[model samples]
Target chain A: MDIPRHWRLRKQRYGLVGEVCESCNAKVFPPRDICPECGKEAKTLYTFSGHGEVYSYTTVFDAPAGFDETAPYTVAMIKLDEGPLVTAQLTDLENRKVEIGMPVEMVTRKLRNATDERGLLVYGYKFRPVMN
Target chain B: MTEKIELLKPQRPVGIVGYGAYVPRYRLPAKEISRIWTEGQGGLPVTEKSVPGPDEDVATMSIEAARNALKRAGIHAHQLRAVWVGSESHPYAVKPTSTIVAEAIGAVPNTQAADWEFACKAGTEAMVAAMGMVGSKMADYTLAIGMDTAQGRPGDPLEYTAAAGGAAFIIGPAENSVAEIEASYSFVTDTPDFFRRAYQKYPEHGHRFTGEPAYFKHITAAGETMLKATGTTPEDYAYAVFHQPNAKFPQNVASALGFTREQIKTGLLVPMIGNTYSGAAIIGLTAILDVAKPGDKILMVSYGSGAGSDAMVLKVTELIDERRDKAITTIAYVERRTEIDYAEYVRMRGKLTMK
Candidate 1:
């Protein structure tokens, strides 16, 4: 939530900009410097295509601290088209209607508020169902 | 030569190369808002309005609409020379919404970006500037957008009508355009029909004053001026789109200007989605463009409550049919909606206070 932390993670927060393993052709999100698949250093930065499908999901009935305003939200694990499974909250859909394999696309959104403390707004990526 | 209207004709013929609109899927019925207050006596003036999710704002909506515009333009985002966003509800107070949009659309590093404000007509204001930039050969393509996740103070009349949505247009030469701009004109006056001072969360308006002397006066003046300047009559236009603050104003204004119900009905969305503030007129224009055939002409007038109106004459081209299907149309967005009750609407819009 501090300035440095926010600045350092911008690439990952925006566009899901990460790294793809050159040696093993594996995709890593929130990108890792060292590829887990081949134990080699990631040399190339890959921006995600942002098209994906819901792989798994659960409705959070119990609100977490600082998230009481948006309780009972559905969070999902999305399998990106480029081969990375990302955990994100499902947006613009009914909690009861969230199903596995629903098509979605990434969008920038306000993640949380630091209103009580530093008055900082944490913005990042969230996924919404792709409109026809 | 004597001129009656100061028509804005870019140095060269500029037209809409591409266009797109985005209305969030979530809808909040006016009755739901009225339900929360419980003290209001009458039925809701508008049926329902679109609401932005907790994560969404003008910046996010503009990015989505701009992406759609780029898709229809069939050009790389890098090829865009300018990105302009006009909105009253820009997310950050100090930061420029255009920069965020420009970076999101990949038009950064060399493109011009700015945020504009003229109330509801802000989007059209940006469009006229974009046309000038492209027509002057200063840029090959310019992206202009009007978007807002507008806010309405609780228990206020504006709350039932202020809504969320956006539309984007790519301006370029007429040679590759889908809708050619024949001519445009602007009218302004020292009318204080609606306004929001600095740091005010919601806007204020002069109840009856916003009607005849503000919305009607500006819209009629600009509408008549554009028509006369273009040497066209109301009968010559296939459709006319007026800035819709609510369902009643556009209908009344259009009728007073000699346009029939059928002529304005196609672009009348305020009854369904409330007023998107800056996005109101441009989104309506996008709807008309979706159904209009090649060679159809449209009269569009946008009113902002400072107040002023920007009027334009546009002629559709054969290229419209080819590009219309390339992206999702306005009707699709309007139809793909889900209704939410007052509680959910409040939560989604982040109206609740958190500790």
Candidate 2:
């Protein structure tokens, strides 16, 4: 499987960028087309520090049928200092310590690919611990 | 010295000019229902309740009630001033069911709207809030609705009573009203009789704890407080509407408070439609509004199992004759209903699902 276009784009940038509205000063992780607060069509470019803390998380035991090979994975909502919540997965702390308020940073990792050696490609964002 | 009334009434008079109700087109018998449910029996509360078809959700059920209400009122959706839907089991937690129903039923120009939730009493509570808005002159006419396709952990006694249905009322002042808001009151208590966690779909409840603290105590407290506020006795009411969770409980509470059978036909909906959660009390109110004559007095009680109760008194106006066909008559709400087995019930309740 080949990587999806979005995955390629994410791979191209080691760091993901977000946007903050000039009118309301509200930060958007996914980079909204317009400001949710002021409805302004204008947005200012900003790179995340890639640092955040876990607000809530859950480990998925029941995945889609073919994804069984990837037995367990963590999905979480992270609160960034920039002031927006982003939905991502926790990594690096896989076999170690991970808590509600654990500090994390963004990392480009291979999520379960829908296709194996001779298959179709699917990928998403995951997170790992920050190096102090 | 007289008490000052701070709440001023709205300008345009609102009334339910149109109404429609849909029960899933299937029926189940008591014996068939009993074979699966361990709790059901023959003697006291004998009738089996109606169930929803697979395609119906809280959204669809509420639309059916709204259609009937709008039809009876003989008014277009453009006439509405605001819309409110009461439900604990909303389709999407963040997205409002009021918008969906409003758009579908034609309340438009981006009207003042929201979804209200407080448990089984949610629908009537929506009714009360809409009354406040119209009474406060915020809106000329408003839609107050209650609906639920509630879930129960399979095999629990609440499973039988947990059912699908909805009721909608348009609130305005009394000039041409079918039912005028005479007085409304509510009593609240911090009783934790039943609750469902956010992560959990089915609810966990203290079976008997719901009876005393949540059901009897709160409802009775509100009932008496309302009666006292109105300075009347049970006999003064031509009808009494209670949040009916089952065939027996509401009656037990009513009889304990001196209400006779003649005073509560609306309360009998549970024996047929099951426990509609937010829809229970409002569904009963719809029925009472159907048959009420001019000058008839009615009392309504709403309870949410966390828990709390709101009691209200309504006076039938001469306009009762104008929109007599607007409500989901008891027969139509029951007759059109479809029935499902324990397994299907489990599927709808989401106790069992296909991956």
Candidate 3:
């Protein structure tokens, strides 16, 4: 079975972050290779807090070619506390229960572990709902 | 000895003279893909394929197409006076990709060559530009090529079809051409069916919105415009080549447009080759050129997600028949596929690792 290429990290910091450019308040995540706003293109370590409101999402009935085992997984775009919305999988919930604007928290866990093209183990984080 | 003082621009009928295709030797087996995505034991009905190699890029693909076009046009690249390449995913964001292609293909120095990017329709648009230029007698011959390396987000449903490929055509005087451009029609609207933000890594789709509004609407509009302009029905042409976003969308759109399923099968390469982005319908155009008999009128319609469409009518000439007998055709190219398993697909597609 296929897994993410970066699924080897032993420590899982389950959350999402984007850059709120100090040069120009633009919230970005996964870290921008360059800044579209303010031309800051500067790589500032802008830390983003999760606990986002779901904007939209899908039950993902058709998981990608390699994500069969993780079938019926829910992927969504959640507007974060930092202003930018991101797409991530919702966990600890059923497909029917996933609703728009549903408050959720970011949690990092083993999405999938597998050998990469270069043949190395990889790991990454996904998201889930947090009940207040 | 000075050239004659030509007050009015001469009109030269430039059209496609030769065509060729190159499908990668590697294929990713659908069962293997299903093994990872489905039950891990061949759970799907279809297998996706990909070209496995690093050096292969939009530039390389264009070269292959140009080489074939030159061979079919029966002229060395040096004999060509103009060249144009249309692609959205050029190797460099700033560099003119046409230079690399022109150099590799030996287009003569001081030739008019550049790239075009109007979403997926850039390739055909290049054809339009070349035809206008050559038709006005600005140049004697020109080569137009369409190529792409489609990108999709990791784990996105689109990953199933973002494959890379290319196609090329040489346009010269119609009397010496392999296909005559019978008619051309286009449609554009302020619609956003699909879009990818810069540095966002993958495209953002509007889901069902893409089906009715941007994709199907524009294709139908353009195809109808061409049919009406040319005064013909679906039964007039032997085949129809469409810009294929998926295997299913083509069928749905064709049924609605009055073209039968048999007519639509000529250029539906998305299911097997994935979405070649700009190369989709144009490659289908080349595939048709490979199989079409002389005098076959193939109706071509291209759709780009940002709500634009171009419909063109091409009548195959005997020149392509001779080339078809000696060179590659769509069927032979389709047969040379080697299937890749789903795990490997993830790696090749950048969705998974080999770790």
Candidate 4:
């Protein structure tokens, strides 16, 4: 990752900052220049409430490059309170405890370290169970 | 005439609008460390210590604590005029944890954010700065946080006590607060009982030297000074929370200062959670606030390794009764725990050298 890419993704990574569709009033994440639902320009920025529920999940036991350190982790499709589903890793929970419909909230965290020496550290948002 | 060390009382009383603490659900038993090292021979200082997952750090934990603070405060994030984070383990060596926390909580653009470091007392340092800002009307509300995913070297004594957790406090006007800050005092010295040099990951300590001259001396001086300045004794306070590096330190200090174990037990979480470093005292204070009734007076003193102590007195208000239910209490977080074995603890902390 280059500096510009890191800079551009900061808002999304930091707060799950996204955009709302003006025409259909749809909430979209991984923010796009155009709304996926209405196929129209989305200039208005939308900040997510960070409240969501697990829609689906899988535990990865197999190791992948750079992710080998954290193998056997749980990744999930979270259905935001708004009308969007986000895919991210689940944290602050045991793999066995994760289930569909479990409430969660977004938290900013280290996504991954730099692959090479002298590389920038990458940070982003992940979800954890919303503790009462 | 000599300049006196006046108790720090805001010109306009500022109170805690909201407060929250977060201890990661993952726990590493002290016995597990002993089992691996001393073969379970020596008694452990703490029962267990909290561990941050691969994704959690000071920033993430601070965000959670800040969110809870916002919830109880019942104020829009935009209404915050300042956010200050104090931590020794700030994830990024170059980046500001406060800005990320401010932006994550939606307080960006309208707030002044900065990071602070004063060893373990960093949290209280932020609180003092926030009190000054809010009390002087420079800011309507300020958020002060102390959090850490503290680190320890493998097999080091520090490993047994260095732990993960944090707490956040919202400071605003007395009218909207759950508890009012009556007065505060700080006592610091050039003692070097503990330190982690630049580029070093683990900290070294003076062992027995850290006791009498560092933790004990500073805490007692601050506590006594605050008591004298406020014209009160230990018996006057309903609860007392001292910086807990381990179970014994706070208990010993409290007893010497004429406070009963009963008065200190409510805020003593270091036995179960280890020392949260910057989060230690504030987390203890938050735990006390969880059960304190209106009109209860609390005395808190925090110690740092460098070393110094920040002492303060707080009085619970009627507002505390109504707002206690606004967010989850500290006990709620403490009660939710899942113990992990030694292997998993090492893995979670990334202690194993990668091949």
Give the DockQ (2 decimals) of all models: 0.44, 0.01, 0.01, 0.53
| Of 2 and 4, the candidate ranking higher by TM-score | 4
Report chain A TM-scores, every model. 0.88, 0.77, 0.73, 0.88
The best candidate by DockQ is 4
Candidate 2 per-residue lDDT, tens place, B2-81, comes to 74322222344433433345444444444555676645564424355556543345665676577667767666666788
DockQ of predicted model 4: 0.53
Best by lDDT: 4
Query: Ranking under lDDT, best-scoring first?
Result: 4, 1, 2, 3
Q: Would you list the clashing residue pairs of candidate 1? A: none
Where does candidate 3 chain B have its weakest 10-residue lDDT segment?
Answer: B2-11
- Winner on TM-score between 1 and 2 is 1
Q: Which 10-residue span in candidate 3 chain A carries the lowest summed lDDT?
A: A6-15
Q: Residue-wise lDDT of candidate 3 within B152-229, one digit each (tens)?
A: 664455656667776887777888888888657678898987887765657788878988888888999888767766
TM-score of each: 0.92, 0.68, 0.67, 0.94
Question: Who is ahead in DockQ, 1 or 2?
Answer: 1
Best-to-worst order by DockQ is: 4, 1, 2, 3
Which run of 10 residues does model 4 chain B get worst, by summed lDDT? Answer: B346-355
For model 2, the stretches where C-alpha displacement exceeds 4 angstroms are A1-132, B1-22, B27-34, B37-46, B326-328, B347-351
Q: Which clashing pairs does model 4 show?
A: none
The best-first sequence of candidates by TM-score reads: 4, 1, 2, 3
Docking class of 1: acceptable
